[model samples]
Target chain A: MKKTVYRIYTSIIFLFLYAPIGTLMVLSFNSSKTRAKWGGFTLKWYSELFQNDAIMKALWNTLAIAFLSAVFASIIGTIACIAMTGMKKKWRSVLLGITNIPMLNADIVTGISLMLLFLTFGFKFGFLTILLSHITFNIPFVILSVMPRMQGLNPSTYEAALDLGAGPVQAFFKVVFPDILPGVLTGFLMAFTMSLDDFIITHFTKGAGVDTLSTKIYTEVKKGIKPEMYALSTLIFIAVILLLLLANSRSKIKSVKTAERGKS
Target chain B: MNKKMLSLPYLFWSIAFILIPLGMIFFYGFTDKTGAFTLENILAISQAEHMKALWLSILLSLISTIICLALAYPLGLILTSMEVNQNGFIIVLFILPMWMNFLLRTLAWQTLLEKTGVINGILSFLHLPSLNIINTPYAIVLGMVYNFLPFMVLPIYNSLAKIDRNVINAAKDLGAGNLYILKRIILPLSFPGIVSGITMVFVPALTTFVISTLLGGSKILLIGNVIEQEFTQASNWYLGSGLSIVLMVFIIINMVLSAIFDKDGEGGLL
Candidate 1:
């Protein structure tokens, strides 16, 4: 009886979470201008999404920003993690707390604060400022993802490589890099998703004439309701789902490989 | 020389980008245009009505956080108990609305809750009175809960999934009822997630001007709107900085109070 009730309850909760997105996706394909009624199914919205230059441009811009921010954040976040690992424990914890303030800080506060700094410094809102800010927020996630793996890593491999006449750089490149590559990749993927998904900070930092998909969506929503916006949202939702699947599969493969390694 | 060379880039990044900007925010909070620091301007700006706004923002945030927790606790438990199939689907459902641009989501809610929108249409179709949820405190809460539900759910889900089933089974085998088991066992174990989720929800809800601006339609004035006005319209950096500081302090105080107040039965670390 309990099991039956549990199953029913769980199904309702899942449906509650998913039903809205499913409705949105279905409405995107609906030929009706209004979302209230399902008129007829057509591939017209997807075609409309493709032919829209502004949407295409925004998609490209979003991808470019996500890519640039992810790469930079991974490199910087990984180095920061490595640097933190060598620090005194008490000092390290303090630094960790300090670095994590951005994560905990309210988005409006952070966005406004960064906006103020940009104005004060006379820094133009463009690719570089947005990238830097993205890295700032993305770094915490990468740090969180990579730090645990770094802690679990056995340091003896690097020591063994050094004792075998390998220079520190050579030892790091050949030994340490391969072992931590999965964690670093996971961090990179996380940063990419975060940068792609960012709205509030991007809205504040994006100057005139520069727009990501998020900013574009915001503008569209304000200017007028458009069915193309739903189409674009559906596309983004699908892309995120695909990437998440790829990440999950890759992590599963890594887990199996690690299990095999342990057995051997 | 080698170590310094290696550390130079990081030092420059942290100092120039992070530390100095933070210092500027602090300095600008105090100083005037001539760069002389004074509390006069800040003090003059903090009137009784501004105090009311501060309290209102805090109260609304507290309420919204509670609602999000009430919704999320059951939902999080359900997510954790289910078999993992299409987790990507589940995550996307949870995260896409959050990712889709906050303004757009707020606008969608506005559309959905509009007098002519789906909710009213459905109500009227069912021979019920069309309710006016927009431009109310309830609307503000609803918008906030919709936006921040995922934040609350994710942390609690993470915690619930991490709980050992054997412990739950042991409690059940000892003839503990579901309610007692949840109250004594599950809730205690998930306190960390609850703490994290509450913090996440409260902080954002406190400063969410967009929701209030769009849905509440000037009915509710949050601290965020006031800060926005100070920076953009009023051009009073000193007052804005002072307000920012006050808001931050208020948020921290609320956090501490809630932490103490909420963790009654559970052994939670302050």
Candidate 2:
């Protein structure tokens, strides 16, 4: 009886969580232009999403920003993690706490704060500003993810590589890089998604003509429903789902490989 | 190459993007149009409309956070009890929704809860009363909970997953009742997750203008809405920055309070 109760309760929670997205996906196929009614089933919106220049432009902008910001964040964050290891504990903690600000502060504040900085510098509020804001928030996620792997490092193997006549860069690449690669990849993927889903910061920092799917959707909602909005969202939702599944399976395979390595 | 040299780029990035931008908030927040320091902008939270908005944001966010906590704890316990330990799958399930463009999902709710929406349509089909809660605080709270529920669940479930089954079994063997075991063992161990979940839910819910905008409609004004308007519509950067500082104070208070509970930041997301 208790088990039945738990099962029923769990299903209910999952239902609550997924019902909206599922409905949106279903609606994407509906022939209805208005959200209030289901006009019938149709695939018109899916094809229309490709032809809609505004959405296609926003999609291109979103992907470019998510990809570029993730790449930069991973590089900067990984280096910072490495450098912090050699620093005095006091300064390291201070920098780490500073890193937490972008993560912990309200996104609206972070958005506004960055906006003020750009205003002061007379920077154009466009793709670059949005990219800058994304990278700022993205770095902390990379740091938090990568720092754990860095802490779990076995130092002697790295030193052994160094003493065996490998250069510092060579030693790191040979020994230290593989262990932390997972964390770095995880951080990179996280940063990418954070950028992909970011509306608040992008909304604040983006200027005329540049729109991510998120900011575009926000404006579209205010103006009234566009049929392509549902199609585009469904596509994004599917893309995210695939990305996460790939990440999960990759990690699982890695863990299995490591477990076999441990046995050997 | 000095190992510290590797951080030079990060240092420059942080100072330029992180520290200076943060300093800019303080500068704009504390100063007026002439670049002179003034408390009036910071004190704008006291205006009747601004105060109402802030008060409502806090109240609605609190309600949603509490609702999320109550809902998540039971679900976390049940999921943990099912022995789905730290597998990447369940987490992916929770996280997938969060990553799905939140604007679309929340706007979907606006449709689902509309007067002639899916729910009302279903209710009429069944000869039941329609849920007329859209465009109200309840709808806003629901939006907050929907958007942030995953944030609460993941942390709580992670912390709960860390509890050893043996300890709980040992407590049970010592004649502790289920309620007693929950109170004495499970509750304290999950404190970090709970605290983390609260702040995770609270801070975002507290400052969300979008959720209120989409779900509550233009009739409702949250502090986030007020600040957003000050920047976008009014173009009052100083006042916008000033009001943001007030939000930051609340966020800091939340972080400090959670820090007291989860000192090692154990309440962090999975």
Candidate 3:
């Protein structure tokens, strides 16, 4: 009886969670533009999604920004983490505190502040400004993810590489890089997702004619949303599901291997 | 190698992008359009319309945060009690919606709650009462809770899953009942997660303009809407910056509380 109740409760919550998503997916295929009644199912929206140039441009911008920001944030964040590992405790904490500012502050404040900064400096609010703002926010996520691995790093192995006559860069690549690879990968993925999901910050920072998928969606809100957007979101959702499943299975295999090694 | 030199780029970036930008907000908040010092912008919060918006934002966000907590705590407990592999699968399911565009997700609710929407259509078919809460504060609250529930769940679930089973077993062996153990051990142990979850949900809900705009309609005004209008429509950067600084005070208070409670930062996003 208790188990039954628990299952029922969980199912209800899951229903609440997935209902909107399921509704959107269904609407994506509806032939009618209105939500009041379901029209016969059709694949026209999917084809139309591809043919829409503005949406295609927005999609391209979204992916490009997410990718570039993640890459840049990963490099800068990893370097900062390494530097932090060697810093005095007080200074390291101070840096970490500063890093948390973007993460902890409300997105609106961050958005407006950056907007004010760009306007003050007379920097054009275009793709570059959006990219810069994303990189700024993305860096902290990368650092937070990498910092734990940095803390766990074996200094002896790095010192041994140095003693073996390897140059500093060579020693780092040989010893420290492999050890922190998981953290770096995780950071990069996190940053990518964050950039992709961001809307408010992009809305404030983006200029005229520069539309990410998010800003594009916002513009369409006052006007009725196009059916093409629903189709695009459906594709994006399917893609995310596949990617996460792949990542999940790979992690599962890795854990199984670790367990086997432990037994050995 | 001067290891410190490696951080110089990041240091410069933060100063330029983070610190200076924040300083500009303060500068704008306290200055007039001509750049003369004035407190009028800051004092604008006391005006009737602004005050109403601020209070509405606070009230609605508080309710959403509470509702999120009520829903998530049990969900977290359930997730933690599940087998490890099952736990992972379920969490993935919870996080899946977040991967979709947030605006679209909220917009989906807009469709469902409209008078001729899915829910109402179903209800009328069944001869049940239709939900007419769309374009009201209630709809806005629903949107907030829907969007932020995952943020609340993930942290609480992480903290709860980390609790040592042996400690619970020990408590059981003592004279404590299940309720006693939950109240004393589980609740206190999950305080950090609870604090972080509250902070995460509350701040966004309080500052959200999009959710309110889509669900609350133009009829309801939020502080976020006021600030956004000032920046985008009204082009009153000084007034916008001033209102933002006021909003930042609430955010800072929440952050300080979270920092006090979650010292280990264990409740951070995974």
**Candidate 1: segments with Cα more than 4 A from true spot:** A1-16, A26-45, A245-264, B1-8, B83-93, B96-99, B173-175, B254-270
What is the iRMSD of the candidate numbered 2?
1.3
Worst 10 residues of 3 chain A by lDDT: A1-10
Per-residue accuracy of model 1 over A106-219 as CA lDDT, tens digit each: 776676677778888899987777777787778777888888888988989888999999998898789988877888998898788788878777866677888887777666
Provide the global lDDT of candidate 1 against the true structure: 0.76
| Model 1, span B50-102: residue lDDT tens | 77777778888889999889988987777777756353455666765654545
Q: So what's the TM-score on candidate 3?
A: 0.96
Q: Could you tell which candidate, 1 or 3, scores higher by TM-score? A: 3
Candidates, DockQ: 0.36, 0.76, 0.78
lDDT against the true structure, each candidate: 0.76, 0.90, 0.92
Model 2's alpha-carbon lDDT is 0.90
Error of model 2, residue B193, in angstroms = 0.5
Which ranges of candidate 2 are over 4 A from the true structure? A242-264, B263-270
Score residue B37 of candidate 2 by CA lDDT.
85
Q: What is the alpha-carbon lDDT of model 3 when measured against the actual structure?
A: 0.92
lDDT-better candidate, 2 vs 3? 3
Which model, 2 or 3, shows the larger TM-score? 3
Q: Return whichever of 1 and 2 wins on TM-score.
A: 2
